[model samples]
Target: MNTLLEQLKNKRLVWQANQQNAIANTDSTGYQELDVALHGGFPQQGVIDIDSAVGIGEIRLLLPALRARQQQTQRQLVFIAAPMQINGEMFAQAGLSLEHILIIQPETPEHALWSAEQCLKSGCCHSVLLWHQQLEVAQAKRLQLAAEQGDALHLLFRHKRQLSMSLPVNLAMKLSPHAQGLSVQITKRKGGWPDNPFQVDMTKAWPTLTRVRHADNVIQLPQSKVS
Candidate 1:
């Protein structure tokens, strides 16, 4: 019995080692600081959860890497049940080809999850991004399995409130707006430490200028030019 127990322990160790090795193989996220924090970037193929406040530019944070992946693979980038309409011109200005993007609007969250899982399992897209307001652990698990089966990058955008809920994803990050740009905190990662929050200047990666009104009845320049 003792010998059998030792054998089982050894097998577990081997499995863990293999998992770590697999996670080590990742693609760059296009931001040097983020890449370092993630120990490379998003896992080559798996579910990544991004939790952020509304209108915080969560999509913008990932635009650089997503654009790079699309260009490299020349495959479709699918969006499932996005809460808001994606502006093709904005993405185009940020270096992503609108032709490569496919947006799907599902009436319900269940349908959105189903569509996203199908897209991942079909291996038809290079990457799948889904915007979901709420997600159960079971649904997240299914998505993770589908991602593994298809070997496609799956990214889920959810509200920051869902950060407390546990999900079986390869990586989970929280994005908050910062003075410089976006503040990213890795809440969970497989085979990687949850280090301190790091700042990624996504503003430079995808520049957008907007006017602002000052208190003294003066029009302020764009935030990018303020400092």
Candidate 2:
């Protein structure tokens, strides 16, 4: 029994909570405040859950980190089942190579997950973004394993309202729109504690996207006369 226990510990199949308090590797998130909250930054390679409403600066918030990963690895960044048409201009503005991006609109949700897994395990992708609304714990575990196998990042984007239970992911965060940028709350992180809600400033990087301090000025044009 003693020898069996030792083997398990050596393989990291078992560990005390206090013993696993820090992640082994991380990449800078580009946002100083967000990076500080996330210890150093996002994990280098693993599954991450981002729960946020679409078109709420969620993609913008991740652009910097994803861009960094793509450049560092010089690998493809694949998108599986994107909700809307991807704008290359936005990616170009963020300094991502347009040629390095591959967008796949899967025919079904199951296919979406399959595509994401393939990209993560291909060893040629730096990151795979999957806009999937439903995911089971088992499925998430499989993706996590695939990410580890290929040393890639798997980003799962879904609405917070759809989440029913905690997922077995490396990191999970909730995002909402804020005047300055995006308000982020760290809900779950492996080897780390949950952090309070904090604002990730986007004004400096994206002045036009951040909310402006101005009163509502309604310009009501005269109603056109109808025949």
State TM-scores per candidate. 0.79, 0.85
- For model 2, what is the error of residue 35's alpha carbon versus the real structure, in angstroms, after optimal superposition? 0.7
Tens-digit lDDT track of model 1 for 1-227:
87977895774321243455426668888889988788788787889988887677778777878888888886789988777778898889878888888999988888999999999988778899998978887888789889888878999988855446867778889888876568899987786556678888755554552222236866778766555
Overall lDDT per candidate, in order of appearance: 0.79, 0.88
Backbone-clash count (model 2)? 0
- Count of backbone clashes, every candidate in sequence: 0, 0
lDDT by residue (1-227, candidate 2, tens digit) is 99999997885455456865767799989899988988899999999999988898888888989988878878999988988889999899889999999999989999998998989998999999999888888899899999999999999998954555877888999999899899999988877777899998898888998877565686768999999
The per-residue C-alpha lDDT of model 1 at residue 179 equals 60
Model 1, poorest ten-residue lDDT window?
205-214
Measured over all alpha carbons after superposition, the RMSD of each candidate to the real structure, in angstroms, is 7.3, 7.0
